[model samples]
Target: MLKTIMLALAAWFAMAGGGGLAQAKGLAPLAPVAPVAACADLARIDLSGATGAPTRQEAKSVTEAGAKPYCQVSGTIAPAIRFEVRLPLDGWTQRYLQTGCGGLCGNLRIDAGKAEGCAPVTDGSIVLASTDMGHQGMDTAWGNDPQKRRDFAERGVHVTALAAKALIKAFYGRDPRYSYFSGCSDGGREALIEAQRYPQDFDGIAAGAPALNFTIQNSFHHGWLAKVNTGADGKPVLLAADMAPLHKAALAACDGNDGLVDGQITDPRTCRVDPAVTLCKGAYQPGKCLTAAKVEAARLIYQGARTAQGQPLEVGPLQPGSEMNWIGVFVPMNADGPIMSGMFASDTINHLLFTPNPATPYTPQTFPFTLDMVAQEQPARALYNADNPDLSGFAGRGGKLILWHGWGDPHISPINTIAYFDKVGEAMGAPTRDGFVRMFLFPGMGHCSGGDGPSEFPLLQGLMAWVESGEAPAVMVAHRAKPTHEGAPLPADGPMKPPPGATGMPKLPMMPMMPPQPTLPPRSRPVFAYPAVAHYKGTGSIDEAASFEARP
Candidate 1:
């Protein structure tokens, strides 16, 4: 009895003495602890073989909820990779999140883990980390160095994950209970790489609009679009204004296919409007109708790239509602004489794929796109492509994967993701595949975000529920943000931002700036897994997600 009383007194003293035992063990304190170490002190941390030199580390406070304090650490990983990690001062959820970078990944922006209405740092409790995917810039010049190219292809993310986990352990005195990876586009590719190459890295992964078929997607697919749209003078046959009539004709034919003329095409595969219908019967008036050349361009875009024998080249057709955004891919820029996709494809092909030697590099103008060239590039394709169908290792270890794609994506074709999902299903068998993977297709959404359909949804929450609770997601509820004029301007006066990254980037030329439509209320819907479609029940308001049912 005396010994028990003494032990009770000791516990009481520890709690009253400002977390005596907890502080020593690096555990959560009984009371809020002051900043343990200066942000700059993080630079002094030894990562064994990995070198980290801090660029900046500071105590920052966010204005969400109760003004949470955090340490924002920015540094360079060994060689040239840049990384950033955010550690919450209080309310650490014992979870770690690593966000992926997009488009050549030259910047060191960390994505806020926002999905399914939960923000990890602000709304929830999770550590966040991001990296610049080795080297810098939106250009492929980094590909000149073989080591840097390999790092960007795979190593950078793995190193960042390991480094961030070490830092989190040091800060909290305990390793995270779970680790997650979230990204779209190029980041999506990173997510798949983590699953296929480093299956032990993340417990859950959310990949949206992944450019898995890296080589052919940027080279052959973009090349076909450029070649088919270019005139004999090497200029674009179609202009931005020329797209309205085509969009209108397409909407008139297919918008009501889903029992609603709501300006969004629910299923583009069934939409078949003849491009020749847009051809002008009389002399062409600019913007009134398309010429023969323009009509041919539209047909080729909708049909997608093909071999001389009419074999589909796995590139997706441009959806009917995607007309407005084609300027970036189909229209020529005055300065470069090529569209955005053309530029990306040219750099990828000449600099990365077919670099005979750095001193004597090939140019897009001189590169040939024959079947022989495609066959010759197989080795490079194998190196860059993330289309590996094997996910048994990840699934066997109980890792959960959630994939999403916008049906009307103007950049990477939705077909590519669909093809990959199908391939995974085939390799793992339908039952086993369904056990670990789920893919959601947004009807009118474009690229990573935004479209006529409800684009904003919480994928992270769904993933968490699946991973933690073992409750597989059947449908994800999505919301369409208020139109631009209702809330803010189209470009919103900020730098281009990733889904949860700081500062918004410029919208692509083909990305439409949706105007205010007071007539239509803000809409919500349910995006279902593959083999399931959200069907209206004909009872509640069409704008409410509750009005739909996920039916297989």
Candidate 2:
């Protein structure tokens, strides 16, 4: 039944693509092509001028029930970069897709992030590939070796694209008519790198929640949060139980700013509610009001990293509506160990961020939050930072870039993405920037997907429409998963809990569930391009996308 539904969706999508906005504008639809080389022959083909002696490990036809047949090729780029490429044996679109990797990528994953609704991917009709970013483990120790560091920084993604396209040509007997890249988080950083450094690699790029300012993000921002939340006893000053009330207060103050009290703040930059307002008046109230120390800690975190002169060190601070997701990062589950933020900061500072590794590793509490510390990251900045805004070459070649970020993202503040977008406009006149780049902010969404607002959207579909037919996306509908139990939303507390034998807090249900049953269609809302917001239309159900329209 599921297969039948997917097949039906695929057919419908193909028909829709045939009559897309491009067709309405009298543009021709891209035609599908056929492969010329046998699957096994891919292993013998050589990639000229490609480094790491690109060697194909296996090339075989993959067959599955109710899905299109495709050639799956796994290979290694010299010195340990692993990648996988999949090419459809039939109904091949004259297009190629390359996916980005997340956080210290050590495994090859070919997901099309934010493009799950794209029929070509759902039906295995497009050529797709992804690399492990030239490393084998999540540990930053690989950065100690200059070659591996270069691979993890920028070389990996670039070389992988070159090799994948070569293989695609070998298998199809022709280069793709168009190519696209999509990624979120660290992958998002790679997408920007491609546009900035290797403009001709892809025709369109989709980046979400990008770790663009790598040096500051992994060091200063994360370290600051870790330091502020840790007490002298080395334990988290803010407890997991504290998140619920804090989040509740934040919503009460700012969730209705967009003229609709729908449990999400449309733009977090507009949220100015201070967490200090929830401080206890006299005696501390558990799970209700914050203590003085906790209040101060939360204040520092929300203000972000700062210099002695009170200047902002990072792009932006933690957002207001993202309070619930801070439990694991700012508040730890264990009593003694470092929190998630500390681990990320320490790994980068000790192994990768600086040129000569620190003799004595800086703990989150010990890392100096000073101008000198910021200067210390310079050696590795060129390799890791993708903050470059100049994309003249890419834009000159008609490359389209889509940037999206979740307004409620607890990791890598969405404000940074906005600032970067604004910088792009400043660098290349707003009119020119608008012609090739578009950014979308998803309200109520977490770092990547889950949150109170709709998160899922047809990002690739929108990108393809823009790149292939010159139709820029104005608004895209994003869907929220059905609540496990309709009308009873899931609790907002993150996955952080006190250790056994701890007291004073009730044991919260990790995941609330209900007996499986048929359910109504998911709620959806329209997400507009930046500077435009969705306004409630005052008509149909607020849960439906049709009930909202984009307002500039």
Candidate 3:
């Protein structure tokens, strides 16, 4: 069946090594077997009190960072998980299977003797990462035992997809043919809980800005600041200078709906700004408008959750580059030191909101997380809620997904990932989901990569050139600037300036995805895919990515 889903997605294009071998263009190999037929003779994959080793690295910007190229291997698989296993030994062949989150998401530790400041483009491709799923310690009691929370959710996705296919067959002693997975915000909800509980693993999967109903987004950030962060003098009422004046009033009423104004809005669903447009059509304007308890806390942080008569809840989607912080950003707004930090606030408020343990850590919990505490954490939240739209186990083993999100993502809600990708095209129908799937969004971005459109392309080399060569992905380009960041915006101090490439960001031209409006909108009557931006009725040049039309 299509060469065993391109040898199970060339093992996640060895974890997006070197812009997946230059925006993929290979595919055709498959028949390679014996990846892990039930741990074939188990030689050694131990974990008893797992400690050091697994985080190994060697030489050069983890070798010219086409995007995610870093190298390493050999296991300590357990010496108590320390971290390391980035691949790509040859020219361009990244192999990845990473993991993180021990102190609010971040794993950029890159060492094997320093210097992987990113630059190896043979159209880069070689990736694999692992922080051992649940670690980076201080305390999360090594991922709250329940058999290490079902081995960090379903045997940490088939032991990092069978230990990066046994370290790419101990470095090309054989194996790799295709594979992919990415992250953003618990790594975009662990890339939709690894394509909804391992749909035959990966051929393609990218989930940026995904918080995936993680117990309804970290209990709606501790229940929306325990209800619009206090005060009629109660204190805590929205700080960080009230999120820079509501992100500068949502970029001054959605900056010209996308035709460019710079600050970015692109589309929070038809840029509808009515905080009553920061109101003032009459009196009672206390402290410069927005009151009625600050427009009911900006309408419960923009129409999310509701009940008790005010109805409407279940929400997601505020697209058009959903900006949620850019530089040195680590927002918490409060509930106790950066949202309690880790097994996501000690396994959602001490074992899924019942809160008990370590001899009464601040009691207050009669209880209510509910659907019976999600059926007692459905085998670790169904191995990370690939919220089941059933990809018939990765499309009856033909697999090829590639989902990517951003559209200004402030931690999750790229319209709950295009409404769970229109319920995965209504449970895989339409040409069997056009031979699998595709969902890029990007636009003036945020989490899992920056913003202001054009996001420097690579996507595990376009999902490993569509898992070895059926060549699926059509559009991918991406890039942004402003970098020069190394402590010097201080006239309060001023004078340092050395990082936007020490000197780089300049690769402009490849944008491709937002045509729609200006008459006959909604995806602008046919453009289908690949590095988009159509219209060449002839007379040449729209700056060409090999001359436009990656689609209709």
TM-score of each: 0.84, 0.87, 0.33
lDDT of 2 by residue, 55-146 (tens): 55578998878879889887777787777888899888778899987766765667676665567677777898888877765557887898
lDDT of 3 by residue, 172-195 (tens): 556555566655555556666666
How much lDDT does candidate 1 score?
Answer: 0.70
Instruction: Indicate the TM-score of model 2.
Output: 0.87
- Candidate 1: minimum summed lDDT over ten consecutive residues — where? 20-29
Predicted candidate 1 versus true structure: per-residue lDDT over 1-552, tens digit per residue: 223323433453356483221111111222322335555566667764543332323234444556466677666666777777888777677778898877766667776433544545454467888888777655577778887877788888988888888777677776777789998888888999999998988999999888788888777777777767777777777776677788788888998888767777877878888988889999886667989988998888888767777777655766787775464445642323446566766777867775463355544334555677778778777777788989989998999999998886777788888888889989988677877888888987766776567887777777876777665666677888555443322321112433443522223233233323224468888776675767777778788776775554
Cα deviation of 301, candidate 3, in Å: 5.8
Cα deviation of 470 in candidate 3 (Å)? 17
Query: Which of the two candidates, 1 or 3, achieves a greater lDDT against the reference?
Result: 1
Query: Whose lDDT is greatest here?
Result: 2
Error of 3 at 333 (Å): 23
In order, what lDDT does every prediction score?
Answer: 0.70, 0.77, 0.45
Candidate number achieving the greatest TM-score relative to the actual structure? 2
> Which segments of candidate 2 are over 4 A away from where they belong?
1-28, 51-56, 281-285, 333-338, 482-522
